[model samples]
Target: MPGPVFLRGDTVSMRTLERDDLDLLQKYRNHPEVRRLLGRVHPQNRDKVEQDFEGYMSNAVNLLACVEEDPVGFVALFDWNESSGHAELAYWVAPEHQGNGYASEAGELAVEYAFDERRCHRLDAGAHATNAASRALLEKLGFEEEGRRREHVFLDGEYVDTVLYGLLAHEWRD
Candidate 1:
């Protein structure tokens, strides 16, 4: 069974990722379509997935994005700096679940949790320059395009640019 829901939105809910869900997580991590945009170039095994899961549990507010108990995606606020009141956000929806507005709604919930519950001052995110959908999602969430890193990540056989985005707590409308 999946862990209890930690945050809930109108159509999506964010839940603590559990050990029981590691297999699904592994599937997502290895899926070529999902991994490409996620900047994951190498295939991941179950052992590696479990190891990463441990790290996520210790280091981040990593959650599974779900809709009515069906897991659809993943979202996280990681690399948190309590003293600096800042963190980074990352999220991805399964290909089958993409375009259903789950990513957007889950992202809103994560942003709210970061600023209100976690009391973060700013949140940062990045997307591959070629990923229009991810870029659009960040913009839709009130994040500003801060800058771009030229040829920052190697994906699908060549280097690609990364577009950085940031959102300040005071700047967040909700």
Candidate 2:
């Protein structure tokens, strides 16, 4: 049998999100740099953290990225339906740890899990039009730009386009 969490790459370890991760998630979620890149929806307080934690724990496909005991990032296979054998993957890294290839490592691991372990045929990622770093990272990890939804999300008093990317299992040879 496979472990509860599958190891993806050497740089970081992938594991299931647990209740103990609430504090760490809230810390990164509230960081100024992270908020600027990802946008903050609500205050990451105790109540909000707890509520989010509940959803993560209940979601079977939720995955957390860690460096030893430190919570570095999170990757989740969201909006999954068995009949489709497909899932959308989303991830976020701590602001302080940006540009260290942590996100790419986390992403590679997520893709491996989706393909090799979960047997998923494809993985999809969506990034804001202005988020060049995110888009570049996804491309480097073998995700191809599928399309763009112009002005789909209204953020910061303006609508922004979202670029959709997809990576198939066969494309991730590395």
Candidate 3:
């Protein structure tokens, strides 16, 4: 079963990620279609996935996006710096759950938590240049495209640019 609700939205609810959801995490993390876009060129074995989960549990505000008890996606505010009040946002939806607005809703909830609940001064996100959907989603959440790193990451056998985005607490409309 999923953890208790941490943030609720119209059609999606964000819950704390749990060890029980490791299978769900692995399902999407290893899915070829999902991995490519996420820039994960290699498939993660169960042990690696477990390690990543542990890191998330220890270091990030990781949440599982669910619909009526079924996990559809994941979201997180990681790399937090309390003194600077800064953090990075990252999220991904299952391939079967893509285009249902779950990610967008979850992202809004995350941003709200960052600025209001966490008292964050700024938030940052990065997406591969080829990931138009991700870029669009970040912009839709009021994140401004601050810069692009030329050929920053090698993915799918070629180097890809990384688009950096930022949103300040004062600049947030909500």
- Using TM-score, give the best candidate's number: 1
Model 2 regions more than 4 Å off: 1-8
Cα TM-score per model: 0.96, 0.85, 0.95
**Model 3: per-residue Cα lDDT over 1-174, one tens digit each:** 689999999999999988888888887888898888888877888888899987655799989999998999889899999999999999999888899899999999999999999999999999999999999999999999999999999887889999999999999955
Model 2: number of backbone collisions: 0
Task: Please give the CA lDDT of all the candidate structures.
Answer: 0.93, 0.77, 0.91
What's model 2's lDDT at 57?
39
lDDT order of candidates, top first: 1, 3, 2
* Predicted model with the maximum lDDT: 1
Give candidate 2's TM-score. 0.85
